[model samples]
Target: MTTPRPAAPSPTDALPGGLGRRFSWRGRQIAWTAFGDGPPLVFCHGTPWSSWLWAPYARALSAQFTVHLWDMPGYGASSMLPEHDVDLGVQGEAFAALLAHWGDGWGEAPHVVAHDYGGAVSLRAALLHDARYASLCLVDVVALRPWGSPFFRLVRDHAPVFGRLPPAVHRGALEAYVGTASHRGLRDDELEALVVPWLGDAGQAAFYRQIAQADERYTAELEPLLGDLDVPTRVLWGEQDTWIPADRAGRLSAALGHAEARLIPDAGHLIQLDAPVALATELRGWLAEVGAGRR
Candidate 1:
């Protein structure tokens, strides 16, 4: 039986490094935690992972920048989107709305840090609404191609069938996919932490529904738009990313025209988890290099 999910953390937490949580957007409860007291840097996590994935980096970067993190819809503490056909379009619109809200009242555009699916979401925001971003740090992002795990292909083809299977099949497939993509593998607590949020029927349905919305054409759109993007963009990659081949790093840089790529020697698909300090240092340096310091 599923126990009550833990109460989401409050906007103001007792943790060190400038922490706050429970930020709302349009009455939709979005679990947001921020740290530091400088120019804002918003972080967006990839699929199956929530904002909690970036907690370490948020803690480290809080010293130099006010780090903002949010659980995307259907993940972490945020409410799932009501629509069943949630795609990049819907997600992009929501993200655009967030940036517009931030620009109007919260503060000026913040430097965006994104990973994997977050990268795509961030790019969508930047391409359509460039005014809300100061700079970008995209890591393990999908771009310029249709590179994805074989498992993703399976999901794309079989979600309708597998999505209807008994709870055990659903649970097993989710666990296996998570295991295959995770480079260093997750500990028991870590696995439970990530898996617990998606255990119920609502959560499972949302997961499949969202997955169905990802269109490979989104990557193609980035290729043409990257050249026109004025915001100084940078790429970070795990040297040994299994899910997204390491070779794609070069492709992304070349396609972006003005972006630089950094390969973290021993990191994997989850760069923030594998090398928090190194990632933070690189980001801080980039922030400084690009004048992304507190405004």
Candidate 2:
């Protein structure tokens, strides 16, 4: 794989800031966008998308809480993980590093909000290092059960071949990458921006490697950790999500101890993008309740 360009200067490197900064943990570099100014609330974006995915909701969330949206290791503005350690455990450790950096001023766990692959990565962190999260909000996340879609099956069979392909072809692949159970379908701009970075040979290779290994190296050990999680948790879903199957909500709801499962009627796998208004409303309410109890 071609070496990744050094992460563009930290968000702090330029621009008078309200929502951008960078942090270096261990030897890894992470880029983040922060909004609001209260106790920390971190958001983790999943595959192909970046922290920018949370912008629509941040408008409202920034009004009441400190919202920190991060570009997971390779997807957004964050630097690529060194070629040596890119598995799930390593990704979770990266998250833990960011959490520690974000929690420097706070005395307890910061509320963690995550979606899709982000949910998997965060759950791994919370499980391996207990007390790292005060509360969690999982949106359209993958649970322990294995229910492979035709797409997933394709990956299982063709990852090696897929990994070697030229990045130029990724432009055509974005449509499939962003497809979800939701009926709205991905808009042109959304699909383009999500896939732009991966259009290069190195980017495409890096992406395929991560996706192919996520389940085998990370999720298999991740599921068992859920039953032991004692943190306040909420699992929300897009009722229309077809990618991972909406039915899995009940299974996740039950497995997460006290986690409540909510369905956003017209939304799909990319719930926040499809129904940011509804997603934010639910998130705000959950945050309110958690805040109230703390008071």
Candidate 3:
């Protein structure tokens, strides 16, 4: 029941829109993509997913904004250093480097759309690195204390064991775990996109390594600073989210003082996949409200 090593990804399979590019950061190759023209909007994907998660949405928003997407170090086409820990803190640094890479091309402060663990990474980059963003939209984020699902706890506790599971076992576990993120169940293509990266030897090891490195300490460090956000922020949640619970959105909104929390009914943690049209509409409206579109 050993999992065979996956062949190298074809150029077209490397990234959505055939736009995948690579850069060296912290001795690792970071993969990213940018498209469209106009003000920049960066999309940060959650755990077990990559920039591919935002492909459709990025295309939707490209008409009005230059959409950027990236796979955090351990996910997608990015380098997965088994010896190094790619925790929230490290992700924040990588994000900062990305901002620098975008430089003046990103205009005055890019807008951010982050989901799941991406919310944690974005928050750390904002608070710790002083990364400037015109506005931010957090969806089904892991930004508060008492976070992590029962399964997340299990993985954190036995990451090494899970990492060493037979390939088929790992694949089954991955598919099942990701399925819970959406209430409507994942489509075959969607599931394959999310699961393919975790199928190979390096990908399999990186999957568990990421879980093992999950630490609330980084989020804890930003909790106190949440209330001090100086940019426009909106908290969006999937009403039926079973992973992080929708109520956390209220807490996040309260922390942001002026930000409002909105819920998309009939959607789950993976709102991008469940209700992409609604998510894109909400984001467009928010950007307009914050005058991000004008920039």
lDDT of every predicted structure (CA atoms): 0.72, 0.70, 0.85
| Candidate 1 accuracy as TM-score | 0.86
Please give the lDDT score at residue 289 for candidate 2.
72
- Model 2 / residue 272 / CA error / Å: 1.1
Q: Which candidate do you rate higher for TM-score, 2 or 3?
A: 3
lDDT of 2 by residue, 29-126 (tens): 67776767667778887765676677666556665667677776666566665364555677688887778776877776788888877777898888
TM-score for all models, in order of appearance: 0.86, 0.85, 0.93
Which ten contiguous residues of candidate 2 have the minimum total lDDT?
7-16
lDDT digits (tens) for residues 196-252 of candidate 3: 888879989999899889999989898999988888899999999999999999999
* CA lDDT for candidate 3: 0.85
Model 3, runs deviating above 4 Å: 1-19
Indicate whether candidate 1 or candidate 2 has the larger lDDT. Answer: 1
lDDT of 1 by residue, 1-295 (tens): 8776455343223235323355465555556666687888888887877776777777777877887877776666677765534566555656777666555645567899888888878887778655468888889887657766887877777777766868877877787777665667766555556566565687787677667667878767666887777788899998878989788888888878899999987788877666767787888888888897654
Rank list by TM-score: 3, 1, 2
Q: Candidate 1 at residue 3, lDDT?
A: 70
For candidate 1, list the clashing residue pairs, or say none. 11-20, 11-21, 18-35, 39-294
- Candidate 2 residue runs with Cα over 4 Å from true position: 1-20, 180-182, 292-295
Rank the candidate models, highest lDDT first: 3, 1, 2
Candidate scoring better on lDDT of 2 and 3:
3
Best by lDDT: 3
